[model samples]
Target: MIVRGKDITGPLRESADVCIIGSGCGGGASAKILAEAGKKVILLEEGGYFTSRDFDGTEGFAYQTMYQRRAGQSTEDLSVTVLQGRCVGGSTTVNWMTSLRTPEFTLDDWRHRFGIEGLSAKDLDPYFERVERYLNVKAEPDENHNPNNRIILDGARALGYSTKANGRNARGCVRSGACGLGCPFDAKLSVALTYVPDAVKSGATVYADCRAEKIEGSGKTKRVAGYVLDNERRTTKTDFVIEAPVVIVSASAIHSPVLLLKSGVCNSSRQLGKNLTFHLTTAVAGRFERIIYPSGGIPQSAMCDEFLNKNGDNGGFWVEAVPVYPALAALAFPGFGRAHRERMREFPHTGASITLVKEIDSVGRVTVNDHGRASISYDPGPKDIEYLKQGVAAAARIHFAAGAKEVMTLHARPTIIRSEGEIERKIRAASWERNSLALFSAHPLGTCRMGNDPQNSVVDPHCQTHDVPGLFVIDGSVTPTSLGVNPQITLLGIAEKSAEWLAENFAAVAR
Candidate 1:
């Protein structure tokens, strides 16, 4: 059953067959699968459980209530603004619902470079298919795209670039463009609406507003302690504990490692919070003469992966549509005072997109502060800096091809470009520094990576901690490398596969 703070008063303690932290993609998937196998699962989430009825359709209200730090979280250097969900479904409730499968090239690279076997795209095909079937994942028909989504297609086609309709994990989407705030219509089938509920049906207990403080025991023991956060009261005073034979840390990459380090569960390797990958991203918005309600329909409708993996080793970047609203667009579009104000006024006529670099060269780290808050630091590699410039230039070209009157980049001086020839020249001249442009990171992964070597990785191929036998990290943190696409599908696939394996071997392992 879904248990909230109101259901309990003061401190509490509980025990379970398995304790899963952070009810997002990985935790939600694992909870459902393990519970279905008759395991008593306790799913812990720091965020509250809310439904469509709870969404008010206001960006400000949603951000303050549903997003991490009211969606204003940034890195240690403030170079990258991180947006992560804080509610029951985790990011699944807030993501754009673009369900792209892990690229085969990415999987192959992980297998060979990171020694992560049993993770090939072929090996994950069945899990991906199952998840798609469960979520009703389907490609939005050409005619179904909103004007904003259509711009990506129109621009790509005009430039003779290969583009594909993005697959979304929803049924009968109303195209409300509110996925970032949380799907108000239930058209966007987040994990809360699908897997989490299925988990509840299997008699799993979900504790919302219960933030996990840490996994208490060291080495092989599984004991978790945390407190309940009452949003209405703005207090996290109540204490709670969960003891299980198996403890799964499915918190996102940034928080998972921090949680581990604080709890002192397994740090023998000290590889807990290293190698963070963000799919480092920046945006470019184009102004068109024709009115384009970019925020009215589905966001992220199309993807141009023509530039991706061209090097044959699965590295490059892609330009994809960013479902832009006035508040977000204003923030993402670089400018200030009158310049920014005038641009938002043309919100109706602007088509916006972001260039996502599959960053690898500039590795980042996640460390906790004195207050145990996460602090992220990333420095871009020299080559990746060039890649970002090229990607933005390409996006500008696509917009120009699609009849954009003008285009704006996140650069400092030569921010706005009117002609195609200026795209590269201006961007090339721009300084390659952190936060040079308005940078955003929705996907934070590879913090607690998986590999065969104990020296370099936290988890094994089975997703269990190398130093702590009963501890497992079934989230994006375990991914060995950066995924060039949206990471929801990839994370769910891994969790599903890991849960199935645990179900089959639980009895033997428990003995």
Candidate 2:
């Protein structure tokens, strides 16, 4: 049964065979698998549950209700905007639905470098196939590409760069271009619509608006203590606790480490809250003479991977188009009052494409502050910054190839390019300092990394924390290295693998 904490009359307590502390791709997958295996499962989510009817397709409503910290969460230095979901469906509800598998190179790195066993491409193929078939992951038709998405397709083709249509998870999508604001038509089959409900049907109890505060383990039983949140007021309404033999922490990379740090468990390696990576992202907007209407159709449908892993360095970046909403565009477009207003007036005629840089040398950390909230910090390596500059230049060139009249970068001072010749000089002159360029990361990973050595890693190849018996972490937090693509499918596959192991060894684990 699914229950909303706000609707509960008083403090509620329950015990189960397994307790999952999150409800995203990892937690949702685990809940369904474990429950179907005949183990009583309980899932806890800090965000409220909302369906298609509640998604109003407005930025104001979506941000205030579904996003983490009202879509304002950032690093300790306030340089990179960290976008994460804080709802029953987690990021699956808010993501653009561009589902991709973990790059084969990444999997190889995990196996050889990190000594992660039994997780090679051949081993994970069956799991990925299952998830793809269930979620309807497929590439959209060429006709479905809006002008914004076509920018990447047509421009890349003109420049002789290979481009491909992105495979999305939506079945009967209407191309509303509001995937980031939560799919209002239910066409996008997020975990909230697919796995969460299926888990409930399999007899798993899910509590929304209930945050897990700490996890305590004693001999054979584990206790999870938390408070029921008053969704509207953002205050604690009641306290609740659940005792079980197995506890799984599937919170995102940022929150998972913080929860473990706060609980004082799973830190024997001193690696619980380290090795953070964000697919560092920025955009280059181009002005077209014709109306592009970037906010109408599919938000992101095509991508150019020509630059990714270039020269076999395992670095570089990939390019995709971004959906331009009023509020987001205002913050992203360069310049002050009058200049910003002028740009907003031209929003209808502008097309923007963003680049996601896969971190090779950059490292970030996630820790807890005095108030027990997540405090994130990151410093990009010099090589990564150079990749960003190259990405910006390449995107600008693509825009020019697509016949854009003018192009602009999201730098604080702004680099404006009128002709193709200006792209290089202007981008090179722009500042690459922390606050100098507007940066964003929707994909945060690698905190609580997996490996063979207990002294160097927090979890083993099976995802069980080395320091805590019967405690496992099955989320993006467990990725030993950065994935060069969208990680939703990869996370689901990992959860499937781990949950299967847990179910097979339930009796031994429970003892």
Candidate 3:
């Protein structure tokens, strides 16, 4: 049964065979697998549970209720806007529905460099297939592509670049283009509508509005202690404790390490909160002669992947269309006062594409502040910056080829391109430093990374912590490197593989 924290009063205590500390893709998948295995399970989520009825298709409401820190999360320096979901379903509920499998090259890199065994592309194929089937993953036909999406497709093709429709996890999508805000039509098959409900149906007890404070105990027994939060007032309504033999942390790349740090466990290697990576992202907007209605159809139906893993460097960027919503567009557009207003007037005629850089040299870390909140620090290397410049220029060229009247980068001092010949000159002149460009990261990964060596990783190949007997982490936090594509499908596959192993070996884990 699913319980709302507001419905409970005073301190409560519970026990289960397993306790998972998140309800996102990883936690939801784990809950379903373990519950179906007939293991008594309890799942805790820090955010409130809201169904399709609650999704109003408005940015104001969605950001306040569904997003982390009201969609204002960022690095300690406030340079990159970090978009993460905080509600029961997590980011899956708010993602653009672009689902892609982990590239074989990435899995190979993990095997050769990180010593992550038993997770090759071939080994993970069944899990990916299982998840894909369950989620109805498919590449939508061309009829579903919005003009913004067509900009990438037509432009890339005109430039002789490879582009394709993105695989999406959806059913009965109405093309409302509100996937980022939360799908009010109940068309997007997010975890809230699928895995979470299935887990509950399988007899797992889920608690919403419950924030895990810290974990305690060791050996064959462990206790997850936390407080029930009042979703509106942000005050503690009550405290709770759940004792279990097995514990899994799926609290995401940002919060997983914070929870571990607060509990003071699983850090023997001091690698608990290292190796953070964000698909460092920025967008370029193009102005077409006619209104594209950029916010009316599938938000991100296509992408251009010609530059991914370029030059055999294991790092490069891909381009995809982004939803051009008013509030978000206003914040991203470069200029002040009248200039910004003039740009906003072009909203109906604007189409934007984002460049997602898969980093190779970027370094990031997640630490805890004195107040116990998460503190993030990231430094994009020189190579990553150069790639950003190249990506912006390439995207601009594509816009011009697609018949754009003008194109502009999201830099503080915007680089405006009116002709193909000016793309390089304008983009090259823009400052590439932090605070000079508007950057965002919807995919944050690799805080508690997985590896065979305990000295270098927080989790082993099976996602179990090396120092803890029955503690495991099944989330994006366990990814050893940045995936060049969307991570939801990849995370689901990882959770399926790891949680199934845990279920089959329950006797050994609960000992």
lDDT of 1 by residue, 1-511 (tens): 9999777787878888899999999999999999999999999998889899988777887788878888988888888888888889898988899898999988988888888889988899999999999999999888988887777798889889999898899887887788888888999889999999999999999999998887876433478998888876778868998988889999899889999989875667788899998898988889999988788888877889889887874668999999886778777777578877887899999988899999768778898899988888888787677788889998999999888999989764438888998887778777767667888889989999999889888998879888877788999899888899999999999999999999998865444
Q: How do these models rank on lDDT, best leading?
A: 3, 2, 1
Inter-residue clash pairs, candidate 2: none
At residue 17, candidate 2 shows an lDDT of 95
Model 3 regions lying over 4 Å from their true place: none
lDDT (tens digit, per residue) of candidate 2 on 1-511: 8899878778788899999999999999999999999999999999999988998899999889898999999999989999989999899999998889888888998998888889999999999999999999999989999999989999999999889998899988999988999998999989999999999999999999999999987546899999999887999999889999999998899999999999999999999889999999999999999889888899989999999888577788989999999999998888888888998999889999999998899979999999999999999988889999999988988888998999999998867899999988998888999989999999999999999999999999888899887999999999988798888999999999999999999888777
Instruction: Pick out the ten consecutive residues of candidate 3 with the lowest summed lDDT.
Output: 423-432
Candidate 1 whole-model C-alpha lDDT, 0 to 1: 0.87
Predicted structure with the largest lDDT when compared to the true one: 3
Badly placed stretches (over 4 Å) of model 1 are 218-221, 412-414
lDDT of model 2 at residue 127? 95
What is the C-alpha lDDT profile of model 3 across 185-282, one tens digit per residue?
99999988899889989999999999999999986779999999998897899899999999999999999999999999999989988999999999
Q: Indicate the worst ten consecutive residues by lDDT in candidate 1.
A: 213-222
Model 3, 211: alpha-carbon shift in Å?
A: 0.3
**Alpha carbon deviation, residue 341, candidate 2 (Å):** 0.4
